[model samples]
Target chain A: MTALAPPRLPTILPLGLARGALELRRFFRSRETVVFTFALPTVLLVLLGSVFGDHAEAQGVTSSQVLAAGMIAAGIMSTTFVSLGTDIAGDRDDGTLKRLRGTPMPAAAYFIGKVVLVAVTTVAQIVVMLTVAVAMFDLSLPDTAGDWLTFAWVFALGVVGCSLLGIAISSLARTARSASAVTQLPYLALQFISGVFVNPITALPTGLVVTASFFPVKWMAQGFRSVFLPDSMAAYEPAGTWELDRVALVLGAWCVIGLVLCLTTFRWRRGQDG
Target chain B: MTDAAISVRGLRKRYRGSRRPAVDGVDLDVARGEVVALLGPNGAGKTTTVEILEGHRDRDDGEVAVLGTDPADGGRTWRARIGVVTQSATDLLELTPAEAVRHFARYYPDPRDPDEVLELVGLADAPRAVVKLSGGQRRRLDVALGIVGRPELLFLDEPTTGFDPQARRDFWRLVRALAAEGTTILLTTHYLEEAEVLADRLTVITDGVVVAEGSPATLAGRQSRPALVGWLEDGRPRTEATATPSALVAALGQHFGGEVPGLSVRRPSLEDVYLELLSAAAPEPALATAGGAR
Candidate 1:
């Protein structure tokens, strides 16, 4: 009998891009995902801004400005961490991941597709948040190029860091329902402790502050706060500073650790413990 | 390239925290271009063995080769030449049959045309969303994706479970078509009729070990079993199992002094022989002491 020749390896980039496009299309098609990712944060921002009013002696700025800046970070976490974590778990439970594993598709290509989806959604969420904040609440963003540069890096790092963590944490969820429920815990807890809901970060207990510092959410909120808030508002934060360098360092570290954890623990099958 | 499309020996696997090994010291081989069915009841190690062959599960101890390559070491190039239809339903609710087929086609080096594959699988006019398709249509979509790559060897794990009669027949026809195209198929099924119709040979397993292996007609010395001869005598039914039903019928004809009344000869069905083989090889309680027993 003659052995059949193996097929040539297909270019991974095109395949990855195709997968990303498919994911984006599916994301947009789902009205629930679109509303949760794009609309909910802006609505929450407006509600909080209206209830708390703009002028606050704590930061010498409107509460809307503080919440809006922090809400962008919260939105990134929701899109990348909460949404992705649940989606991956659902895919695993439904055997989609296993079907993909059976094919010649590379695992990295699948992950690249997920990253692309997160990036696209992140940009859209940021746009909506900023547009609503500026148009409705008179929120002022960064006026200098350097501040914009900081915004870009923080945004990029925040998404990447949270997405990797999402992938890693998804392995712990054996079912789609559990994934949705479990992700909500971190998403809500981070919102409260990371100052997404509160104005003065220093007002929180030291233990809670230290615990929040160990995660990327607080750093991401601080990074965005630095970009959107004026230098005088740094007094509201711990250490009486924005700690921009620490934001970069902490988020960068989480990105590295999250990547390692995901690479080691991600599974194509739902029941696989590893 | 080896003539054997699949070869396994001394295969063993024990699920974590399980008392008995799921697979134990099983051996199997399938010649190139042949359709072989692994037949067993549920939890009889058929899935475990097939998963090992598909490289989806790791075997604890075994020598296995599929298409001349060890599946444990099977890379993307190796994977491209084989297709697998797993037991569980694939959930691609967002994609239409055409879209899914087209997307999977890109993963192969030389995949069949997506439209042609869709037509072949009888999903030419599938619904716009897969979630809207019937169960049979969804299953056909799975088969479409499996064969779109034009794999040389295909592994089908209970492909017809939950299919309607017409759908099952259509799926059998599809399998036959693939086999006619020289694809070697290893299928696992509990349906005796399905195995008889689709497989060129059969491998019967019980309690993680192969108890019988041969063509459907000759498995477990089925051809050697006596045929049952029956007739109507004195307005009452009479039956007898005889080694030579033809000779018995001749004698019965003479006794009747003419054409026999309602005479018929019946051989043992494959299902009967399969059940006997399984019962004969059923594990005794003492066998639990075996090292790999659990």
Candidate 2:
């Protein structure tokens, strides 16, 4: 082989939250992607709340409040996992990722942008759902600042976990159409099992509760339950325990697992074997 | 050292479960400031070779060096040095042209000004909303992003596939300007006219191997091939093939004793040479017929 010329070194761009913000701005501008990201969760929250109006009072809880928290979690999952996954797959399908691979941008920067986009949208969606729930279902705000902090950390971790999982799944989808279908399946299943529609604590089997605990969905829902459900309601649990600390640890574990999977499996372009 | 910008030797790639290699025993050296076009029909492994060079895919065997590093092992630092325009639209739909360019500009160590790149690609006015732009405009944006980094080398994979005549000409001008500025470019196109107009040298690949390599005028000795001398004979069009068109014209000059009306000499075109080469290597005569028809 002949002597090859040296690569023209690129100036490393600053990678931080501010750059993440810039990427979020770009993501929000796409009406279709945004609608898919936030719309389904919002609509589900409203529709479920209206149908279950006053029924929750009989159970000594508010339907809107439960639905609101669930929708917040669901919205984060959709934006970070499903939407991002499908978008990445679409980019690879169209050779967009292939083009970017030749650029100076570090691969980490790309994921950081995605993380920021997902985080921003999660916050927005949570706020909107909470505001709507407060006005329509007489929902109460968190009792203390610690509760609010717990909510924020759990939401953030959940977003990270979902985003990485989405990236991992994107490696499996060869085309955009198939990615859409594959990504949506998990969210639908998780919603029902983790009390997005009904209280999984009462409606689900003990085996499922154990299985859900191993995943991030149960922990995320339990985090929300800590904020909204009364302390006395702990009696309904199989262990009669409020596992906020355990929820945090589980979600953190999920984030780590997701990161490892994404790092190992993600491809900028579709490989022939895949 | 001749300042070789890209170097490859015994490069080989094979898709999984496939017996045939996508790129087989290919060796190439592109010097700094040289414009080398890779010409090949569909599925001729041009894309696989380019992808390996771009560092987007892993090579199964052999040594391949792009800009002094093996692309398969080059990390993010190596990636920042070159530009790539794939045969596809931009992934970003929401980003405006200005925003997209500026965003990508951040990645390069010595990037060109975003505004200048857009202007050079003739997309200065249409800087906002990539989704709103026309196909030609979008392609220009792709080019703008590719050059925003002020790369030493650029890879253009069928850059003008969807361009109109005017847009294609404009792109050619931009390519010429980039080459004049000492940027080594590798372009792959099915358009022989594009190679004729832009490339200083070209390599035609067939069946994962180079069939010919030279200046367009010299490849297959197209310039020296038999020319078709056509003219009006007794109110009817007639043509004759001869290795020496001047000699044939002189003979006709005596027969007519004056200017031969509607007389012209046409050499074998780049397409003709390309087709002949494809025909000889075609899997079947029927396939060759459809290939040339396309």
Candidate 3:
């Protein structure tokens, strides 16, 4: 043979799409994961909104509307952070990661697939949360082009930041069985400290709010609240105004922090593997 | 430079906090297109050795090469040339066999048709979720995924662990076909019959070191070991172990004046050789001598 062609390596985009599609197919195929796991936040939103919807917070803003907006932010975290931390741990435990490692597929392709999975599922999750909020809790849809733009960026950044943090935290779990517990405690505590559940953001201690401000959840909840609630309701915030610039800065910073964490902490195979 | 598809020299690995090395010192080579079977008892470093060669794990001390490149530095192009069937079965729980095969097929530059692969593995009609498949079917699916890439070199670590008798037969047939097509295969199995049928050569490892390596017929000198000669002598039984069984049988028959009543000659079966090798190697990991391992 005179000259043979060089070996062709598999590209990332197509393989990533394939992996993403497979992940979605597997995720939706299991009715339990679809119903109990993904749908848990929506159910919680319904129960919380019903009890709090009657209490009015600010001008034309019922506590339920505020709660609905906050819950949407929490719902994104559920689909991204908690869900991925647990599911990726399961992937590690079940030999999925090792199987893929043996193939020519790049690790970045796996992350792309996860990002796709989170994006589609979260959009679906947000739609359900929004519909329930508008129909039952009287939460108004954003009427302005500016407000809708805010919604888009907030959703994108929240997804990216939380998903990377989720992937990072997954390695901290010793096993898949422990992942849910490990992620859930921080998830629930973040909800409280980030002002997702507590009303009038000022209800939480000032020092606690300052500490929660460093994380993305507080900024995410605060950002979503600005997009959904009336402008006059901004006065009720701890800062007395919707600090959209600060929200962007903090979430953007966490996105970088999350990426760094993932690079340092992600484990493809368990340490015990030999 | 050599003909080996896989080559390892004096490999060793010790997991942290363990008193003994997981893989003490092993040397192995599987030539291009050769189907080499590795046999060992549980926790005998078979998996650790295979994993090191597969580039799934690192060996603390070794010069390892798979397909002309050290597995530690194996890149995507290098990985494209090989396939691995792990010791543990990995199920894509919600995906059908067809879907899983198709998904994994995209990872190679050139992959077999997913449908053809499914049919080849006897999973053509596996319409149910992977979780619902029987143990044998799951193993077949693992083989299907491992082979869909049409790799030049394939490593199977305990590939038939859960297969039934017929499934094992079918798998042996597949291995034969693969070997016939010039695929280099390194197989680890407990079934001696399967190894005898599939492997061109056999390598037995124990206590993280190679105890024996040769063709299935001659491994551990199975072919040359003394044969047992038995006959009935005046209503009593007599037997002798000798290198010249035919000559001894002939003499016995002549001594009986016509025919040797109930005469039987037996050579060491592959199983017998394997058991003896394992027992001999089990004690004293230090007795595993290394000389021309290079």
lDDT of 2 at A231: 68
Cα RMSD (angstroms) for every candidate in the order listed: 4.0, 4.3, 4.1
DockQ of 2: 0.52
Error of 2 at A82 (Å): 2.6
Ten residues in sequence with the least summed lDDT for candidate 1 chain B: B285-294
Query: Which regions of candidate 2 are displaced past 4 Å?
Result: A1-13, A16-19, A56-60, A271-274, B232-238, B253-262, B281-294
Model 2: how far is A69 from its true place, Å?
A: 4.0
lDDT of 2 at B79: 72
Q: Please, what are the lDDT tens digits per residue for candidate 1 over residues A77-170?
A: 9889988999899889888887787788887778878988999988888898899889877778789999999999999999999999999889
Model 1, span B80-160: residue lDDT tens:
889989877657787788988988898888899899999999999875888889888888888888888889999999999
- Per-residue lDDT tens digits for candidate 3, residues B148-190, read 9889999988888867888888888888888898999999999
Using Cα atoms with residue i matched to residue i, what is each candidate's TM-score against the true structure?
0.93, 0.90, 0.93
Q: Write one digit per residue (lDDT tens) for candidate 2, span A5-91.
A: 553444333553535777677676667767766678888888888987766533577666666666667777877888778878887
Ranking by TM-score: 1, 3, 2
Q: Which ten residues in a row have the lowest lDDT in candidate 3 chain B?
A: B285-294
lDDT string for model 2 (B1-294, tens) is 347889988888888777888888888889999999999999888988998899877888888778888897887676766888877765677778888888787776667888899889888888567888988888888888889888889999999997899989998999999999999999999999999999999998877888888898988888778999999989899999899889999999999999997999999888988888776755576776676655
Summed over model 2, clashes come to 4
Whole-model lDDT, model 1: 0.88
Error of 1 at B173 (Å): 0.6
